[model samples]
Target: MEARLPYDDYPVVFLPPYESPPAWVPPHERLYHPDYNNELTQFLPRTVVLKKPPGAQLGFNIRGGKASQLGIFISKVIPDSDAHRAGLQEGDQVLSVNDVDFQDIEHSKAVEILKTAREITMRVRYFPYNYQRQKERTVH
Candidate 1:
């Protein structure tokens, strides 16, 4: 039989079989916080929506939807664009798109609905905050 060293007298050491500490982790596609993408402020839409599909990788969730309201809003309607021609105004709070309430839907699901909708009828609360309409603001 092999002899065993005394617990107190043995030399304290980490075995070589163990892996070394990680220096850096490889970057991967991942959700930053709150929602899946990085900046919510950048992606924040006046309209919110929910959607589901069997082939979809992510489960049902909410995402930025088509603009419901139009000016000095969190979501801006591009000038002379489809959204702009649709009578959508800035600072409009989107209650729903295609009559679907999107208060708490997930991001992935929202994308699906927006993509699939043929004729979207968005219900909006316009200019509740009294923000002035302006040209598109640029992020510096």
Candidate 2:
């Protein structure tokens, strides 16, 4: 008697081997692709300018820390909001807002500065996944 394997009667289809995508492709576009490795080493820090009309929410949260610590980090970005549309992401360390350095500023003062501005320009650095992982390992 011959042994029967499951789905043996079905026709076989083979696919080509996967190749890594070019580094220039935006991170959002690479998501879900089989060859995407989530490496953003080549990504450079950029400034994002967002102009919010009166009564428009900034759509993000900020956490204030000591003056000696690093700049305030973007804790959260609400989806489909002004911040999200402006490409704001969690873990972005903010360097400045509208040409003002808030690195050592008080949290409330920073919040006030952002609150009064209709046009906000933020310089942020996005820490890559590998870098963040390494930071965590060293912290512990």
Candidate 3:
């Protein structure tokens, strides 16, 4: 029987049978911390830099901000888009965009920052399992 660790929608095997860790993981893709007590439990912040082609969209949806008090989160990502190719994912918290701090920015302001930039460098962190709980904690 395959022992599996549960996730909200993505169950994974505890480990691959007798396989050693990868010889290397890309810096942006490394799992730097695994402690439950860490505010970010399972993922590391990835800096993704994307430059939108002329007249083309960045192709991602965002949610949350200071007004909403939910924090900035990536609500959707379009497949094959630059954002997707850069490794942005749904539920990723946008810590910064174009190096502008997003943690306390208003919704309208956040929208403006994303819309105005031709090139964006963002630090994003994804925490799928405890997303709602984390948001709640941040709110309180």
Q: What Cα-based lDDT does every candidate model obtain? A: 0.45, 0.73, 0.76
lDDT of 3 by residue, 27-112 (tens): 55555533223244448888999897667888898777785555788878999988988898888888998878988888788888
Q: Which stretches of candidate 1 lie over 4 Å from their true place?
A: 1-74, 127-140
Residue pair clashes in candidate 3:
none
lDDT of 1 by residue, 11-98 (tens): 8887436567634433463444333444445324444333325343221122133232221132555576556655555556555668
lDDT (Cα) of model 2: 0.73
CA lDDT for candidate 1: 0.45
CA displacement after TM-score superposition, residue 84 of candidate 3 (Å): 0.8
**True-vs-predicted CA distance for residue 114, candidate 1, Å:** 1.4
> Which of the numbered candidates is closest to the native, going by highest lDDT?
3
Q: By summed lDDT, which 10 consecutive residues of candidate 1 come out lowest?
A: 131-140
Q: Which stretches in model 2 have alpha-carbon errors above 4 Å? A: 1-43, 128-140
Instruction: Please estimate how well model 3 matches the true structure, expressed as its whole-model Cα lDDT.
Output: 0.76
